[model samples]
Target: MSDSPSSWPDLATLRDRIDDIDRQLQVLINQRAECAQQVAQSKMAAEGDDTHFYRPEREAQVLRQIMERNQGPLSSEEIARLFREIMSSCLALERPIKVAYLGPEGTFTQQAALKHFGHGAISVPMTAIDEVFREVEAGAVDYGVVPVENSTEGVISHTLDSFMDSSLQICGEVVLRIHQHLMVGENSRPDKISTIYSHASSLAQCRKWLDAHYPHAERVAMPSNAEAARKVKGEWHSAAIAGDMAAELYGLTRLAEKIEDTPDNSTRFLIIGRQEVPPSGDDKTSLMVSMRNQPGALFEVLDPFHRHGVDMTRIESRPSHTGVWNYVFFIDFKGHTASSNVQQVLQDIGEKAADLKILGAYPRGVL
Candidate 1:
């Protein structure tokens, strides 16, 4: 297991080469940052008082190119993350934008916002999903991030319903791998843990795992995984199922890791904003279609997508919240609103449906 005499010299040389590479990377990053500043100045001069520096489509295109061109010892995702943070920092130099997410500081939505926007942007915590929407609509924040769906559980109804009334657009999407860990405070002993705290979905996600492991523990549904992590800090015989961010924020000891019943559990979140993001070459469109109470309503609305050759990714139905309108269908399809096939589908559906609202046409998630 020991290195040969010949290998020792190569190891030292490799370390030195790494140092040289780091120096070159530093120079290139700073140059990029300076260029971003120049871009801001150019916009200010050209656009007069209505200067906007952040472009969701532009960033998405850059990241897509980064992934496409990657040839790496590091993974495409690994390299893309490095570029994402670099772009975030450069964007901050242009102008730091504020984002609000559903949180008490360490929730998954906050993690999604940071992942999508990068660490350079200011991310504020909101008490509820509706609050996040209100803040963005009122211009209290530049953007808001909210959970849309989970792989194990179905769609988030609150977020989908929010679209029914709000004017906010879907600027971007972030998919976070959700890892639920069993954790306890310093005062809690591993064997003595008798109760488990987690959000309702977290508890449901880990149901089978909990049955096999901590069968006797009482499972309590908290308002959030963060709130569960917060409460467990003061209780001796209590543990919480939460993600890494919450566990780290609370400084709790992890008793079990990746305890979700489903191995690849993840949640999708959306970036809600005022600006309509242009197509990133790769994109998806979300729409809310209201249909009157009539026979073949579903087939009539969806046939257009099939006829136009538009791929419908998801379709969920909700109550229209009115007596006259019986069905409110939320549809997500593959293509930008700008494309001919997509426009054709919209046009066909517009003639049949009671009302149609284009929620957003946004870049598909990069990471």
Candidate 2:
């Protein structure tokens, strides 16, 4: 069972090679840190502001460039993550941005939050979506991230509803591609897998695949995918449906990959903060309106956008809860609230609708 002498690596040579690689990495990391300091100095001088720091746009540009020019055995994603951690370390020389997201950890929302803030900022994972907003509203966290919508499914109604009552502003956004995986405990065999657990949405998304493969396995809905993974033990006849990252985070083995019903499933997340986002050039504004419960009343509400030639991206209605058949319409359009077209539309809609409220305008999440 022992390796042949010829098959073994030369220990002394390997050690020397490893030392050389380490030295190279150390030099590169230091150089990157120095550049970040220079960037900080320049930003300070240009803005003539001491308190202003952490450029989201510039960080985004750096990651975009890395993704564009990457020619790698490692993917654009892997390369970008490397730079993200590097920038995170560099940013730590200054103050850390505290961000909150819906979580108990190992959730997709947590991934979006981390992707947006990088590892530089302090990430606080909350149990509920409303908690994310509260942290940012209370100034306990500098910003918050929450899922706003999905590609296949519709908007996250709870998030949209929460915005109707909250005072926080949408400062930015990021879209993360959702890849679901089936994971089980290390000691569980594939044949022994029985019950599967996950969040309801996760279970629904993978229903067809699960029906085809594990038809007899009982499906259990849990609060979060991470919690579902946590519940699976080696002795139990159970496995959990989650993401690959969750599997790695919780020491679970992947039973399958990309097991969702659709290949392009993605979720859009919003960044909420106290300050308004100065136009990022490309942006979307969300609004809520309550129209009179009458015929063509909805058309009267939407007629302003058509007249102004503004692009309306999304429109959804929720029961106004004001007794018999009252409803509220949530709208997403292709311009920021600061733009003239958007401003005029708001002006017109204010005159037309029973009630209207501008949620927030922020950069559209490109990724």
Candidate 3:
């Protein structure tokens, strides 16, 4: 006879099954951690004290593999993030990574650092982009994360300038989707918010939204979004425009969400490290080229890339500090420096340009 609906396993039975699965998950996770520890031992035996535990390219490849193999109710990105945290914990069994980022804390740079290195990393907050570079250069951290460009605001000139002075390599890249929110303190009244505080870029990104919603409100630019959130905490007449990270860090309530005028606004951040990252199957190379001032100098510099069929992803011109009239082009393109075609293109461009610095070849952002 067929069983009645009541005879089927109830919610409690399903929960018990979940408990059993959790137990199995715990066992498998510990086993993975043990394997990571064993891997560390093998590395130490092979390379002694000079062994590098963090392999950025290998990590990127693993994450991409996980995403590709994922098949579940969860999205590929969600699965990859889960694997990210798992890898983070396992890597901690070997050694924790210390990362430096531009911050007062609770900033997007910090978010990118955490996203790339996972929670197992020790993240140090630096006051400025230059400070972040200095910390990594001084061996105070394993790596540094800095904002290179924003979709809406163009390139971060300070970050680009820092690269010109530092020898750090680009180890990896992270693209973070930015969602600016209008937040207020618990004691603040949304109706009485007389002023809005945010960073200049944030203000600009949300200009249209602010104009439509709070037309008469005075907008003030602060040093950073976290600073703006902190300033609004004690003021009943002020609100802050920042991201969810800042809002949660300062215990502010979101009055409106995703207030940025551009719905798909995102920022690209770079991971700077003392050690060079080997090429992953998929990679990108960045270079800063200074061409002799002449007609078609830019074309001469770019022609080699096109001739080689190397896809140029982006190119930005910055004023050269060495000469008033000279300009440097920061170019990013697909393929790794180690690849034959990339090497040929670089050699060709090197012959044409006054100076060419291959920043580093790193795996493109997968998640």
Candidate 4:
């Protein structure tokens, strides 16, 4: 039976229904906020006045549960994001977290930070990745977010190197899908863009696209994409290849959208903090292993993971700071460090490796 306009509720009635739902949502949200407040009180009572209110594992679990149980018109990611904002607001009622990211603002690292911590968090921008680590280590910020690797451009070696010098633990991770855009200022002539600015990795990511479209344009690599966007704002004949955030921040118009060579380009960012994150059921642990410069050293290090049934997600070798010829392997694998098999694997690797540092075991990215 098809319902006609006369049988269906009028626009006014539909609006009234929406208003009623909104009111109910408001009440429920407040109730949730009150419960969060009570949680804060309980934590203070148990762990003194300086208690850490942010629980990465607990938040990850809650978000995962929300996504798993959601049966709605909204997508799982959308619902998870809504809950993320709610949790962020509730956490602010307890304690507002300050997060540092590699940026001069409008950088992807900043986007990743906001994506993970929500808009309620205070996000600070640092010029370099090491500065982000420094701020967190110095207690200037509660946490820091930095890019670890990109799907299109490969690993960020600077981030991995920073880990070697810092004691910050990876508390969480967030993966951002990279979508590069060709943006220009209002006065800029699209046909006369003589130079394009972007980070080296970004330039490389869009190499094929740029080669085909703007073959003669001079590609200048900048420190960050946001910086490139900023640089283009003053020049009429120059354009910038940046992300949506940067384009919006600088009021640049996108002449061309999604111009990356690869459609599935993405970057994985790590959340760094001072404290260890407890196990979330679905978690990944990152470790740095420095093996002796000997035959089968890599085999000995990786053999334990295979034997213990640990699934290795990634393995990247970086030049060891300790020696000229030596290399350190940055390994990421599924399973919490506290798990029996993971523990056994680590123990075995510890025996074989010259040095091993467990960066952290954090919940995998949820959105």
Candidate 5:
């Protein structure tokens, strides 16, 4: 809108300088990768084959430092994302990590996995959330990414329930900003759309939007939005409500973009793995505690957290499978389990609660 190609007098000089910088950047990146390889070799030599190269806390710390030291035209998030790819690529040189996510393909969970681990990680799609957990538990994949909650629709019960039965620890978390789109295949006409398909959650998220735009179109629920996109590919009178990844994967064009009722709709995903992450200075701990069906049991259990000065982030209650009226509380708070105050709170809760499980303490989502 402003600068013309011919108007820039120093364009050639700037281009040459950029070329030089690119070369230098390439050299430095390779140097960092070489150093990563050496680190991998040393770890393997000292600890044998079981040496885990992926450290969630370490990566979180590195990315935080990158953002802290950054002074550039690019925003902090943009710069951190660039470094995330570099770290992902370098880690791949040591050992390619396999991540399992809930999907047929092209779901937001898949996108979140890629965002957290980068394109360098090998992402395998699981047909269901439980399958993703199973894959990680069975050692088929190094980690699993599953949606825990959405900003618009509240918590994902399936993910929380899965944690109730699993021994896997949460190693990391990814927060993805969701932008729902109405898409249709080439064979479909926007004016002719008589039906819309999406996951129950996505449909709920876009309820008002769909009502205003396509009032008469029948809304059908699918197992997942990506599946919805796939089912509509050959339908001449159907559209799917999904994200950009699904639209591109199914070769559909967006009829309407960001169609969710909430502009700030986003999803938080938990990274489930076998390993426990260390303290990252800034971290969050999640717990599952069960209490007897007593009147003051709830307050008695939670009072310790308030007394200890530990910041509680979230708490969700589900039926305790062991008893008729008993409940299990899934609690999240700021601070590591290793910290003294957190340990004290846990001890107090342990004395009162029937059972308690420390799900994991993980680095807060960086990007």
Candidate 6:
């Protein structure tokens, strides 16, 4: 009865179909949210606790189930990200989730925060890593995002150090693929470039490219790569090494892209909060321990993990900072604290450790 008997539907009809789908999606979302409210009621009645919001273990279990049952057309990581937003939204209806990250806005940390938590969240940016933890500990923000490690570099020691004494828990993690770009003002010339600016680490990461092309250019290190981009101008004959987000934020043009040392450069970020997340099926537990400065001491700390068949994902050591001639070991393993094998390892560590602390157990990143 329409003008599109043999052809595709008209624009208006197609638009109406989209609207119909939106209505259906809205209804399903509401139903899902109503179920979450019911869950809160059940928890309040059974546990006599009204403040229970995060369930890291339960979240992990859901992701694990999805990953295991995932079929073609959608990768496990993609499916998990979709569910993360769904769950984050369900929790938000009860309380708004506020997160703090190292930012002045538009930093990679900010992007990671948004990626992990959907647009339904409030994000606060701090100047330093310690400030991020401070905001979380003070209850000003619900969570904090800080870079943990990079594929090109090693780890962010400042972040690792902050966790040593902070009480905030690692609720989740988001991994961002870092693509460094050389950005400059629209009127700038590449051949006339004489100065390059960026964070010291970023500059170091792109050392090979800089050395090859900008041998005569003076490299400067700034507080942040974004800040460096902000400093570039039409007459400066300079560029900055920063993420694409920063270039967009500062209205700079990207002269080059993905100029890092390695093609697979990515940064892993941690989401810290006062509340613990329920286990998502795929979980990682992090810990820090102080061991005697003796031979086989490090191996002894690792032995229980091997015995329990737990997979060790990362292990790094830092000078104790508490005293001279002492060190602390930070280890990340593939299991939740609530798991039988992980529990057994922790029990063994309890009996054998000089000093130890479980930083937090969080969902392993997808993609």
> For candidate 1, lDDT tens digit of each residue in 1-367?
3676754658778899999999999999999999999999999999977777888889889988888899988998989999999999999998898999999888999999999999999999999999999999999999999999999997999998888889999998899999999999988998998999999999999999999988999999998999999999989899999999999999998999999988989999999999888888989999999987888999998899888899999999988877654879999989999999999999989998889999999999999
With candidate 2 superimposed using the best TM-score fit, by how many Å does residue 310's alpha carbon deviate from the native?
2.0
Q: Candidate 5, residues 70-120: lDDT per residue as tens digits?
A: 998998899999999999999999999999999979999999999999988
Number of clashing pairs, model 5?
0
Model 4 stretches astray by more than 4 angstroms: 2-6
Clashes of each: 0, 0, 0, 0, 0, 15
- For model 2, residues 256-280, the per-residue Cα lDDT tens digits are 9999898999988988887766666
Residues 130-237, model 6: lDDT tens digits: 999999999888789999998888899999999888888888888898888998997678898989999888888899998987889999998888778888845468
Question: Model 2 clash pairs?
Answer: none
In the range 113-186, model 4's lDDT, one tens digit per residue, is: 99999998999999998999999999999999999999988999999999998888999999999999999988
- Cα RMSDs, all models: 2.1, 5.9, 1.8, 1.0, 2.3, 3.8
Worst 10 residues of 4 by lDDT: 1-10
* TM-scores for every predicted model: 0.96, 0.82, 0.97, 0.98, 0.97, 0.86
lDDT of all predictions: 0.92, 0.83, 0.93, 0.94, 0.94, 0.85
Misplaced by over 4 Å in model 3 are 1-8
Q: Which stretches of candidate 2 lie over 4 Å from their true place?
A: 1-87, 321-324
Among these predictions, the greatest TM-score belongs to 4
TM-score of 3: 0.97
* Superposition error at 193 for model 1 (Å): 1.8
| Inter-residue clash pairs, candidate 5 | none
User: Deviation in angstroms for 175 in model 1?
Assistant: 1.0
Please list the residue runs of candidate 1 whose C-alpha ends up more than 4 Å from where it truly belongs after superposition: 1-9
Model 6 alpha-carbon drift over 4 Å, by segment: 1-19, 30-54, 57-91, 233-235
